[model samples]
Structures are given as structure tokens and as C-alpha cells.
Target: MESPDHILVVDDDAEIRTLLRDYLERSGLRVSAAADGRQMRAVLSRTAVDLVVLDVMLPGEDGLALCRDLRARGAAHLPVLMLTARGEETDRILGLEMGADDYLSKPFSPRELLARIKAVLRRTRALPPGREPASAAATLAFGAWRLDTVGRHLLDAAGTVVALTGAEYRLLRVLLEHPQRILSRDHLLHLTQGRDADPFDRSIDLLVSRLRRRLRDDVREPRYIKTVRNEGYVLSTAVAPQVTLRSTAPTDEPA
Candidate 1:
């Protein structure tokens, strides 16, 4: 039998930690709690955690910093669900920018948090129904970059590997699969994140900006991923699939 998914919960609030631990445990998941980044790291070092539920406010290192650090340490594929006391849009944007898979504001319902956790895990572990697997193409080439669908690495013209966060890779893959077509923010959000975007949600736009940065595409005159005035964004380039040997360069997560 497969082991239950392990969750690492990092928060300074003892009550919150205990609350989540007990709540999640009741839901048939193995959970470990940490007080801060130090304990979080300790747990991560010794445990095979499937997901991390990180709080933005902590004792030493904030959740944003820790999340960024995790990405820098090549844990891109590991799902992270960020929690923040502040309901500000900037906090959510920063969390997403730092490679968080999902964000939730504090004073949230445990049931809701559990739902989000399951949603994020589902997204990271498998493709949604009716969606083709990335493995269908060995490599997808567009412009000067080639994406190793199997290995999930982005290769440059010189075959140098460029790290991409899970979110970035998903957005890029969606664009590449539907090149030369305008994709509204709602559509892109649904395709990449498996959810509809709220009126105030700009996660899709932020993801596009991050992806453009990864591709080194100038925002003003992007050769690929062009923006349509009010509709949305498009790849504006053709994607060619190549069955080639994968890059041997060392792979790391996005910083």
C-alpha cells in the first residue's frame, strides 16, 4: 500500500501549527509541524514531505524568503501552499512570484486549506483530464529555447539549462501548445492553475512576466508571447517538436 502524503507545516504560532496538524491528520494525511525556517529545514532534510504549508509571518526567515530558498535549492516540483495573515494583493503576488503553487490568507477555514492542498497536489502530480502529457514531445523548440518535456528543463540556444519554477513551466507549456493564438487571462489561469481567475487575480499576468524574464524576452517588444491589447497574450511563434538527446547540464530550480 502507498504511504499517505506527508505535509510539512511551518508556522510560528503554536496554536495554528497544532491546529493544522490535528486537522490535517484527521484528513488521512501524515503531517509534521515546524516553528520556523530552521525547523522547517530540519524536517525537510530528514523527511520525504509531499507538500509544504508555509506561513508568511514567521520568527526568523519569512515564508517568502523560505519559499524562494526552496526554489533556489531545486525543489521546483515540490508543491508549496503559502499562508499569509495579510490579505493584501501584493503578498499573494510575491508568494506566487517566489514560486508558491497556491496562496491562502489567514483566518482561513481548515477545510478550505485542505481543499487547496489537495488541489495543488493534484496539479503537481498529474495532468488534468483531457490534457496531453508533456512527454508527448521530447523537446519543444521555439525561438532560441527548447523545453525538455520529459525532464522539464528549459534549454537555451547553447543547450545551457535554465531553471523554471513549476508555475512558469506550466504557463510556457500552455503557450507553446497553442502558439499564435490569443489566450485570455482566465483561460491561461484555468489551463495552468486548474482554476478560474477572480477579477482581482493577476497571478496569470505575473506568471507571464516571470516566464518572459526566463526567456529573456523584452516586455516592450517581445518576439514571443506578445500581448493583445485587451484580449490576452499569445505565443506569436510556431513551436517545433524535436526528438533529441536531453541536456546533460546540471539542473537546478529557479532562484
Candidate 2:
């Protein structure tokens, strides 16, 4: 039988850690609690955690720094769900920019946290229905970049491997799969995040900006991902699926 998903809860507050541990365990998930970044690292070093529930406020090496460190250390595919006491939009954006998969403000319902955890896990572990598996094609080439689908990262023109967060990889893969087509924010959100967007939701836009940075595309004049004024965004280039060895390098070709 498969083991239950293991979650590592990192928060300075002992009460909150205990609360989440008990709550999550009761919800059919294996739970581990950490008091701060040090403990968080310790748990990760020795455990095979499926997801990390990290709090923005901590004693030392705050959650944002920790999350960024995780990404830098090649934990790009590991899912992270952040928790913050502040409900400000800046905090949310910062969390996403730091490579967090999702964020929840404090005083949140345990049920809601559980739901978000499941969503992040699902998004990380499997692609939605009707989507081709990443391994189907070794790479999807567009412009000066090629997505190493098997590695779940991007390769630049010089063959530099650039890591991608789980969310960024999913968003970019969706765009690559449907290159030259305009995808609405709601559609992209549902396809990549497994949820519909609300009127005030700007996560998809933020994700696009992050992806643009990864692709080194200029915001003022992006050649790859172009923004549609009122509709959505589109990859204004042709995508080629490369499954076998090729003699020549890929070149940019407009779709």
C-alpha cells in the first residue's frame, strides 16, 4: 500500500504547530511539526515530506528566505504552501515570488488549509485530464528556450539549466502545449492550479511575470509570452516537440 502523504508544518508558535499537526493528522495525512527554520531543515533532511506548510513569521531565517533557499537548493519540484499573519496583497505576492505554491493568511480554517494542501499536492503530482504527460516529449522548444519536460526545468540557448518552481513549470507547460493560442486567465488558472479564478485573483498574472523572468523575456516587448489587452496571454511563437536527437539547434520561429 502507498504511504500517506507526509506534511511538515513549520511555525514558531508551538500552539499553532501542535494545532496543525493534530488537525492535519486527523484529516488522513501524516504530520510532522517544526518550531522554526532549523527544525524545518532537520525534518526535511531526514524525512521524505510530500509538502511543506511554512509560516511567513518565524524566529530566525523567516519563511520567505527558507522558501527561496529551498528553490535555490534544487527543491524546485517540492510543493510549498505558505502561511502568513498578514493578509496584505504584498505578502501574497512575495510568497508567490519566493516560489511558494500557495499561501493562506492566519486565523484560517483548518479545513481550508487541508483543501489547499490537497490541491497543491495534486497539481505537483499529476497533470490534469486531457493533458499529455511530460515524458511524452523530451523537450518543447520555443524561441531561445527549451523546456526539459523530463527534468521539469528550462534550458537556455547556451544549454544552461534553469530551475522552475512547480507552479511556474505547470503554467509554462500549458502555454507551450497550446502555443500561439490565447489562453484566458481563468482557463490558465484552472488548467495549472486546479481551480477557477475569482474577480480579484491575480495569481495567474503574477505567475506569468515569474515565467517571463525565467524565459528572460522583456516585459516591455516580450517576444515569447505576449499579453492580450483584455483577453489573456499567448505564446506568440511556434513550439516544436523534440523527442529524439537532432543535428541542428532550435531556432525561433513565429507561430
Candidate 3:
């Protein structure tokens, strides 16, 4: 039988750590907790963790720094879900830009955190054993960018590869799927994050900004993904399918 998905909870708060460990373990997940980055590294060195539930506020080597280090240490493939007490948009954006797959504010329900963790893992295709894997979508090409749905890779016009986080990739894929159609933040959040937007959650906008920066799309005059101003955002470029699937129907583009 396949082992359960393991999670590492990194937080300096003993209460929160204990609460998470107990809650997550009771939910049939294997969880390990670390009070700080040093302990986190120690746990990571000896264990195969599927995901990290990181608290943004720590005594030393804050969660942002640790998350940045994790990405730098070639652990970008590991999904990270950030927990923060700040609840500020800037802090959330910083966490996402630092490679966190999702963020949850403080005083949150344990149920919601569990849901967020599952969503992040699902989006990253890191489900536990006995679960069916999601099928890859078709490869999409627009302007100078090529998205390989099979490999979940994004290649630039110059043939160089662009690294995108799970959220960013999902947002870009949804935008590509509905070219020229303005997708509101609520719709984008539902489609990509598999969750509804909280009144305080600005994760969708932050993710869009990060994707824009990665694609080198000018915010003032984006060439591909355009902001529709008070409506939503749209992918303004035509996409060509690089992979052929007989089951798919051709899309008609308006002249």
C-alpha cells in the first residue's frame, strides 16, 4: 500500500504547532512539526515530506526567508502553504512570490487549513496513494511562449524555460483556456485554486502579478494577458495547439 502524504509544520508557536499536528494527524495525514528553521531542516534532512505548512512569523529565519531558501536549495518542486498572522495583502503577496503555493491567515479554522493543504497538494499533483492522477491538458502556444501541458513546463520564445509555481501555472492555463474572455477574480480563484475567495484574500491578484512578471508581460501595457479594468483579466493573444488530440474540437476565432 502507498504511504500517506506527510506534512511538515514549521512554526515557532508551540500551541499552533501542537494543534496542527493533532488535527492533521487525526485527519489521516502524517505530520511532523518544527519550532524553527533549524528544526525544520533537521526534520527535512531525515524525512520525505510531501508538503510544508509554514508559519510566516518565526523567531529567526522567518518563514519567507526559509521559503526562499527552500526554493534556492532546489526544493521548488515541493509545495508550500504559508500561514500568517499579519493578514496583510503585502505579506501574502510576498509569500506567494517567494514560492508558497497557498496562504492562510491567522485565527483560521483547522478545517479550512486542511482544505487548503489538500487543494495545494492536488494542484501540484501530489496526491497520496490510491488516488487517481489528473490528466494533463493540451500544450498551448501563444506569441513567444509555449506551455507544455504534459510536462507542465513553460518555454519562452527563445527556447528558454520559465519556472512557474503551481498557482501561477494554473492561472495562466485558465487564462489560456479562455482566450479573449474576461475572467473575474472570483471565477479565476474558483477555477485555479479550487476555492472561493475570502473577503480578505487577494491571492488571485497577487498570483496574476507574479505570472505577469514571470512572462515579462508589462503591467502597464501587457502584450498577452490584459487587465480588463473593473471587469477582470483576459488573455489577448491567439493560442495554437502544439499537440494533436482527435477527441478535441477546433475553436473558432472571431475575425
Candidate 4:
């Protein structure tokens, strides 16, 4: 719709990749393609891409392994929308865990695929700019391991970094911002999503449920975030601000 934006299509199936390439071009977006991880890396080395349309099942390494590798090395930051044949809920959850911004099952319409791509890109572009790089703080320690918000990464009692989706991070940030203060669903929805809180939607509840599971906090008796019944939710612990990352060259490196 807007001018042509470059998108990389990575899938072992050449037919699907070709079809998407042409369709995306017709939609006013330029598209690149890769058959596997190696080609994906080669293309990445040569061309700049805005977003990636990736398949979970690849030739050699699976998509999740690649996602973790990219994060560890800080190689790429492009938002990814996964395409998968698995229609199970576990597959959907795993896709999110693999750093996919969004997902779609097989037998999806190309128009629907386009819509999902747009949604993922829009959501990713909307996140606030972080003060530091993602790897700056792997784990944030606030009040015990009960409250941790190190940008996209949270931490547990064992000090292991916890993976959080974009929405979960945003929601957690909102609660941590006003710890101990009661914020209604409307306020939270506006603060975190910049959208009106739906009276009937359970998006917030679902995110909280996922977060609690990862944090190892029981929903019945929470220690970090507590439910206020009709009002909303509040962080039960205190928050300490993140410090700026420092260069370690003894402050004598040449400018």
C-alpha cells in the first residue's frame, strides 16, 4: 500500500516462496527469498530487509534454533512472522517462544498472510525505543526475583533470563511503572497497548497468565503482580531503574 518495502521470504518450498514474492510485489512491496538458513544468511549479508516471512520447518536447522542464534549474536533485529503447517496450540506457543512476532497456520489465504505480516510489523514498530541494546541486561533484579523487567528479558528466582513476547513486555512495563498503584483495565490497556480496553476481551488476562507461568509465580497466590479483582492489577514489589551501560576501554579509547 505504501511504497515498496523489502521483505525476505525464507522457506524450503520454492513454490510458496515464489508465490509470496510475486504477491508481495503486487501489494507494492519488494521481496527477497531464501531456501534455507545458509541462503538466508547470504542474502542477509548482501541485502537489507525490513521484515522476514519465515517458515518454522527448514532444511537443516529449525526456526527456533536460528532465532536464538540471532539473538545471542545480535545479528538481526528484523521482526519475523512465522508460517507453519502445525495447527496445534503448542505450535503457536512455540512459535512465539522462538521470537516470532506473530504466526499463521498452513492453508492460509495469501491475503490473510499479508494482513498478518502487516500486523506483526505494526506491532514491532510500535514498541518504545530502548535506552540500551537488548543484551545490555539479561536479567533485571528488582524485589527478589519477583519483579524483573530488563527490557524484553525478565528473570526468575534462579536468575535465569525469561523470554517474553512483545505484548507481555509492554504489559509488564506498565505494571512496573506504577508499582503498588491501582490501575484499571482501561488505564492499563491504554498505557500498554495505546488502544481502548475492550470490556469483553481477555487479552490482558491471557498475557498475565503466560507471564505468571514463566515467572514461576502461582496465579492463585501471586507475589509480584496481584489482581485487584474488579479494579485491575498492581505490582506488589518495588522497582529499581536500569542504569546506563558503560564502555569498558578504561575511557581512553580513541574517538
Candidate 5:
């Protein structure tokens, strides 16, 4: 389990909301409850939260719509986990594509919910200001590129932003944390993959390639990311103090 952090849960089911709020609070997390998207917006406008446990179905504006709006607006860096009725694979996949950090089906165990939360927070190493491992929360910037480890957004020097898929975000995060270091696909797979490490149609290489294209990096004579031949890839550069992404495009193209 992760250390204490604020968690906002949005669900119309009063029973589920109460149970989650009570359980999360007992687990050492500050909890906030919202009945729907509107309520969630209200809460978000006033307070800050580390993660969001969003229910897929809401009374008026549905959770998926809310997720899209949140991602497009400014919460792109904020991690969102969706809840749905069990056996809803379509919703699960759609949620992932929409940039949700994770999801849970109904009839889920509280223990599982807690475990997922811990995993994400651990991988991200999120912490508030004035916390332990001071550098862990530090933001890294390379030219116009900014990686806010805490806020979880990548900002360009021009103040534009590019939204990253959850998996891509996690994979890039691991790479950035170890700049100038060559991490093989296997090692990266192990760090980013789920439990059991099931050997499925999985690998971070394709994602890396896509990421390189977005960074406008030359694969042959790369600037930001360098290929290590049969070994892996290395990012060679020092991150500036802060780089603000435009929040306009996912990543800016070379002008």
C-alpha cells in the first residue's frame, strides 16, 4: 500500500461510494465523495486529489464523457481509474484508450482496489510538496519538454501539452527516470507489465517507436532518444528546471 494521499471517488451508488470512502480512509488516504460528473467537477474545482476512482455510469453525463473532457481540459496528467459492472470488456478497453490510468469491474474486492492504487502510485512515485525523497517529486525539463512527476503532465516549452496514454506515460516515466541508461525491453516489460507478467502481445518497443516519432526524434541519429542497437534505448540529455507543454497538441512537431 502507498503512503497517505488524497483520493477522489465519483459514483452515483451511495452504498459503493460510502464503502470506498470508508475503506480508503482507513487505508490512510484522504477521501472525497462525489455523486456524479457535476459533483466531481465541483469538488475538483475547489480541492486537489492524487487519483480519481470514477464510475463508468453516471446519472446525466456518463463517466466516459467526463474522462474525455478531463483529459482534454487539463487533468491529462491526473490518473483516473474507472469502475463498471463486471463482464464489461468493451468499457474497459474504451476506458484505457480514453487515457484512464486503470479500471475495476463490479463485484470487485476492496483489497484489489487498494492493490491497484498502490501499484500506480508506486510506479509514478507521487508525493505532495514537502515530502520524503525530495528529488522524487522534482520535475524534469529538457528544452521545451517538461515532465512533472507529481502533477503527471508533459508540457512543452511553448506551453502546449500532449496527452499520453496511460501505458505510454508509465513506460516513458520509467525511461526518463533512468536517462542515459539502456533498459532492455525485457526489463521495461517487467517493470511496467501487470502481475503474472503474462507473455501476451506485449512489449514497450512499439510504444517507444511511436513515442520517438512524436518527439520528432531521428531514429538513426536521435537527439532526445538514442537506440543501443541490440541492447535497448538511451535518452541523452539533462532535464531543465521546468518545461511547460502547450496543452494544445499531444506533442509538438519540429517547426
Candidate 6:
């Protein structure tokens, strides 16, 4: 049997913590709750957390600070879903800029939160829910970058590994798949994130910015991925698949 995804919820409100723990657990996810950053660190040290559902307004060391700390502390791979108060667009944007995978405003429905959690997990794990798996290992070579689909790693022209976060990898892969096509935020969100994007959500754009930095593409005069005026972003490079080779024993032994 597949293990349940473990989630760590950090919120100062006792009522909110209890509410989320009960609700998430009922949704078939293993949940751990922490009331503050100190408690959050303690829980993280002991458990293997798959995702963190963090409340933006904590008593001390708010969610944004904690999220940044997490990334700086080598927890970049861990997915974070921020819960901010409704109408706090600035908070939501800051959370995304701080390396959060997704965000939801407070007073949210349990069902919506559950869906967001699943979507974040799908993207973080690079699993296509309800989709067919690739027949073989696939690699995409574009410009000076080589993406190993099976290994989920990127290599530059010199063959050095280029690290990518979950969101960055997903966004880059989606762009690579649809080269030269203008992908709107909605389409990109659904394709790479496995969820519908809210109109106010700018996480996709923030993710693209991060990816661009990693690729060292100039934001003003981007060479690889370009921004379409009043439209969306597009990968202008040509992408080609690299063939995978299998090794076999020699048919005849050498004399």
C-alpha cells in the first residue's frame, strides 16, 4: 500500500491548527501540527514531511520567514502551501517569491485546500495524475541545456548538473514540451501544476523568474524563454529529443 503523504501545518491559532489537522487527516493525509517556528523546527527534525501547509500570520517568525529559512537550510525540495488572509495579494505574492509552491487565502474551504495539497504533491513529485507514463527514458536538448526527463536533472553545455526546484523543473519541462507556443498562466498552471489557477495567482510568473535566473537568461533581453506582450511566456528555443541507448553483452566472444 502506498504511504499517506505527511503534511506539517504551522499556525499560531490553536483552533486553526486543530481544524486543519482534523480536516487534513480526514482527507486521507497524515498531518502534524505546530504552533510556531520553534515547534515547526522540532517536528521537522523528527518526521519526514512531504508538504508544509503554513499560515502566513504566525506569532513569531511568520510563514514567509520560515519558508525562506527552510530553503536556505536545504529544504528547497520540500513543498510549501501558504495560507494567507483573503484579499492579501501582497502576502500571497511574497509567499510565492519566498519559494512557496502554492498559496491559498484564509477562510478557504477544506475541499479546496485538499485539492491544492494534492496538486502541489503531484508537481513536487513530478507525477502526472491520471496520465500515461512515458514508454522510455526521454531527454530534451534545447539551446545549451540538456534535460534528463527520467532523472529529472538538467545539464548545461559543459554537462554540469544544474539544480532545479520542483516548480522550476515543472515549468521548464512544460515550456520545453510546447516550444515556441505562448502558454497562458492558466494553461501553464493546469499543465504543470495539476490544478486550475486563480486569477490573482502570480506564482507561475514568479516561478519563471526563478527558472530564468537559474538558466542565466537575461530578464530584459531573454534569449531562451521570452515574455509575450499582453499574453504569456514562451520558450523560443528549438527542442529535440535525445535517444536513450541500452547496453548489451557481445554476441560473440573475442578469440
lDDT of all predictions: 0.86, 0.87, 0.81, 0.69, 0.72, 0.83
Report the lDDT of model 6 for residue 254: 12
* lDDT: the better of candidates 3 and 6: 6
Candidate 3 regions exceeding 4 Å error are 126-138, 244-255
Model 4 segments more than 4 A misplaced: 1-3, 75-77, 128-168, 177-222, 226-234, 238-255
Itemize residue pairs with steric clashes in candidate 2.
Answer: none
Cα lDDT tens digits, model 2, 43-101, are: 98897889999988888798999999998887888899999875577777888999998
Model 3 lDDT per residue over 1-118, tens place: 8788999999988998899999999999999999999999999999799899998889989999999998878675688999877546677888988988888888899999999889
Residue 77, model 6, lDDT: 71
Say which candidate scores most in TM-score.
1
| Model 6, span 79-117: residue lDDT tens | 999999999999988898888888888898888889999
Please give the range of 10 consecutive residues that has the lowest summed lDDT in model 5. 246-255
Q: What's model 2's overall lDDT?
A: 0.87
lDDT of 5 by residue, 1-255 (tens): 764688899999999999998998898889999999889999988987888898898999888889888877756557788897887777776676566766778989888998988777665443332342433446677745876654455667686766565566677677777877888767776676443323432235566775676577778777887778878677777655543333432334311
Residue ranges of candidate 5 with Cα displaced over 4 Å: 1-3, 126-167, 175-189, 193-255
Cα RMSD (angstroms) for every candidate in the order listed? 3.7, 5.8, 7.1, 6.4, 7.5, 6.4
TM-score of model 5 vs. true structure: 0.63
At residue 215, candidate 5 shows an lDDT of 73
- Over all chains combined, what TM-score does candidate 3 have? 0.84
1-255: candidate 1 lDDT, tens digit per residue: 988999999999999999999999999999999999999999988978989999998888999999999999988878899998756778899999999988998789999999999988877766321134433436899989898776677999998998888788888889999999999999998888888888899898899899989989999999998999899999998999887543455446332
Q: What TM-score goes with each of the models? A: 0.91, 0.90, 0.84, 0.63, 0.63, 0.84
Model 2 clash count equals 0
